[model samples]
Target: MTFKEAAYFILKREKRPMTAREIVEIALKEKLIKTSSKSPDRDLAIQIYDDIRLNGENSPFVKVGRGLFGLREFYEQKREETVGEVQHLIRRLEETQYRSNSPSEFEEVLKEAFSFLGFETELKGEPGNTDVVLKAKIGRDESYTVNVDGKTSRSGKISDVQIDWLSLEDHREKTKANFIVVVGPDFSKGNVEKRAQKSGVVLLKVKDLIELLKEHARYPFNLLELKRLFETPGNADYVVEEIIRSHRDRTNFLENLKLIVEEMENLQSLLGYFSVDSLVARTELGPQMIKSVIDLLNSPLIKAVEEVSEGKYVLVIPKRELSKLFGRLASACEQEKEQKEQDDVKNKLVKNELTKDELIKYLSRTERVPTVLREILLPLCLKHGVVSREMIKEELVVRKMAQNLGQAGLVLSTVSKAIGENELLESIISYDKLKPWKKDNFRLKEEYKEMVHAVIEELKGKEQPKTDLKNRLVEYLSRTERVPTVLREILFPLCLKYDVVSREMVKKELVLRKMAKDLGQAGLVLSTVSAVIGRDELLGAIIMYDKPKPWKKDNFRLKEEYKGLVQEVIEELKEIKGNLQHGT
Candidate 1:
């Protein structure tokens, strides 16, 4: 038989707790087993200890005392009886309200309780200060000190004012102790409990301490173990339970989901919609267990699946979709984290202004102008540009300019000079000013009207075919100014189909051509057409002068001068299509 089996048989036969040496000697005398080791008793003891430690409560041998072993059932019965006796002692102590006792007498009782738990106590506190200072040997070379402040009241309940006398922080600073305990008859209010938690002060009622002392008598705890209770004062038990629950949740739910996904053919197959009942049937897990697994699987870290409808879920495993969501979240988090870093860099730039080359490199890497000082200094460092410090200052003063000629002239001149010198400029256009111009349908000053009329007259005199003329005009306009591309692509086609285009005509064309997928896209196309027509000098000349009524079916029409040119272009396009169809 194995050493484990022999030990178990010996323990059962003895019918009582026995030391390893006694068990080994009795087994050898009875000729139950044989071993050649010089220290047979020690080997047997090590074997028995290994079994009990490995199996825990399920082990055949139970540890009755230091180096003593007995049958499991027998030891359990004795431990239960001891615990019962300790509980009874606690109840008896609780019935005798010790609040009426003198302060000194109560201090003595507390010291005795600590002594029973193997701590050495001293009356180091003054009459009006803490009552006792405790020192305990936690290890062979390590020691811990704790300060205990005692508060006693004639009434059974102790008020918050009385509990405040503990002053945990003051005692900790004065004594430099590892922990502080405040023992009182009872806490009076709920707020006192909250204060104790925040202060890290262990509030032990007189009855509670008596119960702890009684428990120590039954099952003594080591100094290191007792120190843990003092170190984490209030709700330590609840904290430990929560930690254990979190660990269990990760292991059981998250790990199981990973395993389940691994066994599938592909994650995409799971994207098929599934109800809770269907999921339970497919995974072969209990309904409640499956629900918990689903909750954990839906988190951002996993994001393996998401609920699509009521009581239905689908896998969202596409990396593109997940990356978009993660990108926004990550960008926000990075901005918040880097704000302080940016501030530090800004301070350094202000203190030791960078050289021209260093500033260029810094600006290349960073996205925004670091500060107003940097903006004002930038124009001075450039070798060639009309944007002087005064010009930049002027631009800053007029914050919003829909048709501010001075700002516009400054922007154009600076850009022209910068290009001539082959110098890089950050941005020529002010986006804030440009936004209002676009929103107002590109309203321009009266100076621009003559320019628009001249372009219209030039188009009317063109001798080229209308298709070629239209293409040339579009190309020239795009090169000279910012022209919206959608207007050229979608609006020109509709103008060819109908001599004049209406809102309904545009929407129908968009749907038939599949240029837009929904109302939002259609609305965007219309807004682009409006902005482009309002901005282009030639188109503005045609549409602004021939403005149709708001409720008219054909609300947009080419002016009389441009109508013949558009018709010829449509005819030329039709001829090209006919030739392509006939393979000419």
Candidate 2:
């Protein structure tokens, strides 16, 4: 192994900081690393030094003291050092909150604050516009804008200023914003409060905004949670405080996680394995709390526990290893969060450099695909390699995804921005001249077709062999003895949309080699449908006994309110396995 890799193993196993010489000695003694040099310790130290020097904060090795090194993974977990910019910005905001000789200066700081919280901010320079407009986009479809009226007061209270409560709504309407708020150092009682309440405007104090900044700088970045800031028309402090309470609850969960993991480690020695309910009973704790802790242990970063039975779990890793993982949870989470944000900026900067595999992977994963592309366009693309631009609008209308074509176009535009350049967009789809960015006949590039077809099959409920199974086997064995889960999932969604679906319709849908030509397995298919919809109800479904003596059902009808259950089943069946998850 390399010097750095060996050092990492040693540091993680030892769970403590060590000098380079000590690490080298251990590596050599255990044969974790090989080196023929007389001064192997000095060589390892030089390699680590060079790594830290080059990568700086991103290095795997961090200097703890004179010649002492530790894995950066478990180093100081607090985000205080990294949140320097936020700290400085908050200081400037606090200084200017009360009284500002220069309104633009305060506006500039406010803009920085908003931008820091992941909003696109613009100082409305025009006379009629609000002081600032802040826009936030949630995913591809939903977006909201905030018209912020910045008030500066000589008396450190907004009552000193001529606050226009009347134009707030007009300003929101003019700016096409979802919400409008008045931001100041503080507001005097009576008139200011009365006017804001009457205008249905949110009175946001600088201190509350500062509180949000402080919270953002902490371990849990809650910028998205702060959406409640615009949701209610009142003091925004309540929203910020509510978010803080959530973080506090998360803290409690973390403590519970410690208790659960440590207790599970002890119990594994005594009981071998335990279920969530068993753990709850043994500890005399709530099942929900134990289950929630189990969820955390099963997270991607910390896979300390694995389910041995249906609900019973066993500790997968040793207690020391688990402890080592959660030791630096705060810093590790912060680093990962920061890395993703940086990667997003990097993705946008690239001009449609997505590969064929990447395109397929993006569309196949629900999180990666925009809602329009996933729910509307891609489904049609699966049927036709080249779906027309109008087809997308039509599908959106049919599905009620958008109110009008104009809104559909906005949704498409958001998709365009997400997918990147027009060159890339047009390469995939035939485009119209007017809104050429995302509008066009959606088509797959020739290179993307083969892999995309495979993904299309996967989306169409093509199941894999046993190991790719996730409750499919157990559910299938117990619930429907003969019918396959995939066959049922395909028909389930279709059943929800229509009152009466027949065997002939299912046969037509499976025109491909998906089903056999002869109706040998027809009974199994009918049995699967009946098993889901209620077999007792299937007795009524039988129209009559034919002259041949066999009973036949004419149509498939999902009893009312089964739509939600049907959709859930379909989603569970289509849970993508293998490479689709986080690009593997």
Candidate 3:
């Protein structure tokens, strides 16, 4: 018999977990198998692992621990307890979906899905009221409810003939739901789909809903953001795709950040500075971000990147501690992961987790911006166009999310993450933090204000929430001019002399000019001042120059694409320098 066969025999007899080595030895001694293979234990372990992973539940072999194995039958005897879990409800759904008359059970499953999706649900009478009422809280005060109806078919297909369209509307009116949804296994082509579209009811397929739930478990959506799905009309597939896109973006971000933190910490450079471009080119993991995006990471919350000169930056925390800090920050910036369960169902997702040690080890390396925070700040950011750390902190505290200053500060730490989320829409159109080194004011680029307002318009749909209209933000873009001393005194002199500036250069200038009180604050204000004059983009080009210390590069390389934007801005900046020289 083969080693795998022998192991099955040995395991059945042992009735306990055994390491691959122990199993191989027992099989050989008993003469259950003969192997000429040099590493029989290794071979057996691979076979067992492949069998379990490949065959899934069908595989008799079960992994016990590192290099250990157990029988599936052994564990099946002792089932684990759960806390009103969604997985079991889904399985129950699978069973109920096939039965023609089990509409009630299907309704129950849909209710479970709503709960799992973090909605406040109520299951009511079938003939009279809607099957389910789903209330979702958008912010601390804003909330809206959805009407849900489940359709079941023995043939696993639902046609318009099977549903009461007028009755569904009646249920919607009676229930007073902001929106109505009809969910079923399948729908008839012409009438069912046409009526759903014509009447504005969402016909959500069971399989599609299940897929959304699985994706939700993997990358839990902020309830406020998830509400976007209900507000959107048309196929349920659209909602599924929306959630899928969000999940992919977040997963990509976490992994990239982890990489940067780990890589920068490794250098441990004496000067403790590196170019962003060279770093991205070498690591091949940097996301497409503007230079001022540096300000986000440089914020008090993350403190991951410190932009010293034009395009140079240093990691504030080393690799070992960075991983731990990320774990804590990711947990703090968690986006509504409370109701979702971490399950590994064969076809389902394994839930988005940022705490894994290998940095997860550098995935979301840059920042961990929670979706909830993005939702909270969306309208506020759009209206003001210029915000302070205090304003953001006050918003979070008033939202009743974080209690007091400390908790509010924890929530605010994810502001770097917020920058990331909004930046994906349009890099320059989003936040350009002017003072990341301090808890101070920052503004958006004036040129991109209109485009940003359009993006904001898209996020906030036609249907307005019924919450109090207290925060009716202004229609016009607003920013009082802010020209800090660092912009004129410290940064300009160095910028004129050097194509590529170092953190050291700016620090010395700050000390010489007596613009900053101390070296510590001087270091903080380096690239920060340039961000105000919108020269941060030039620094992005310079970021690519560093190729590690041995081949250390100091020359500023302006990338082809950024050349035009940089030249135009530099001309305007030179005018600023001229004004300074003229004492006007």
1-584, model 1: which lDDT tens digit per residue?
A: 66567778888877887766677778788888888853455566666655655565577776564346788866783364345445544553354335343344455456656765679898643444567889987675668888887766777776667665356677777777888887767777687677777887777776667645664654465676566667677534443344334445544664465544442224336655765576565677667776776675588676767887887777666545644666566656755534553344334323322232333333322111322212332332232211243444454455332136565445434433432343222221111111212210111122222222222233335424544656855454344232333444456556645667777667666666677787667766666667667666656654532335542223566665565454544455656558889999
Model 3 lDDT per residue over 1-584, tens place: 98788988889998987877689878889888888864466567767766765565688986654235778887541121121244665676777666553355567668878887889899773345688899887765768889888877888888888778788788878877778888887777777777887777887888877777776655566677667667765567777777778777766665566566555655436446766675576577544632334565788987877777787788776667867787677655542341121112211211111111111222112122332333445456567754556777777778765668787777666565444455342233233323442223334433334333444443345224311111121100011222334533444344545566666776777877776678887755654544433344324433334434442333324443333333334444566568889998
Q: Each candidate: what lDDT? A: 0.54, 0.63, 0.58
Question: TM-scores across all candidates?
Answer: 0.26, 0.43, 0.42
- Please tell me which predicted candidate would have the highest TM-score against the true structure: 2
Count of steric clashes across candidates, in order: 1, 1, 16
Candidate 2 on 1-584: residue-level lDDT in tens? Answer: 88889998999899777866688879989998877764465566667766765575788776554345677887752243336557878897887675444354466678878887778899763345688899887775667888888877777787824687667778878888888788888888877777776677888898888887776666444446666777777677677788777877666666566667777877888889978877886777788888888887788878878888798789998878777777567556556664564355334323222343355444543331344665666668767754665677767777876678877667666765665554434455432222334345455543334334444554446223312332443355224333444345445555766666776666555544355354556545654544544443232232121222234445665544334434444555455433356575
Instruction: Please state every model's RMSD to the true fold in angstroms.
Output: 36.0, 25.7, 31.8
Cα displacement (angstroms), candidate 3, residue 194, comes to 0.8
| Residue 178 in candidate 3, Cα distance off native in Å | 1.7
Best-first order by lDDT: 2, 3, 1
Alpha-carbon runs more than 4 Å astray in model 3? 1-86, 140-142, 267-271, 285-296, 329-584
Q: Name the lDDT of candidate 3.
A: 0.58
Off by over 4 Å in 1: 1-97, 124-126, 140-142, 165-167, 235-584
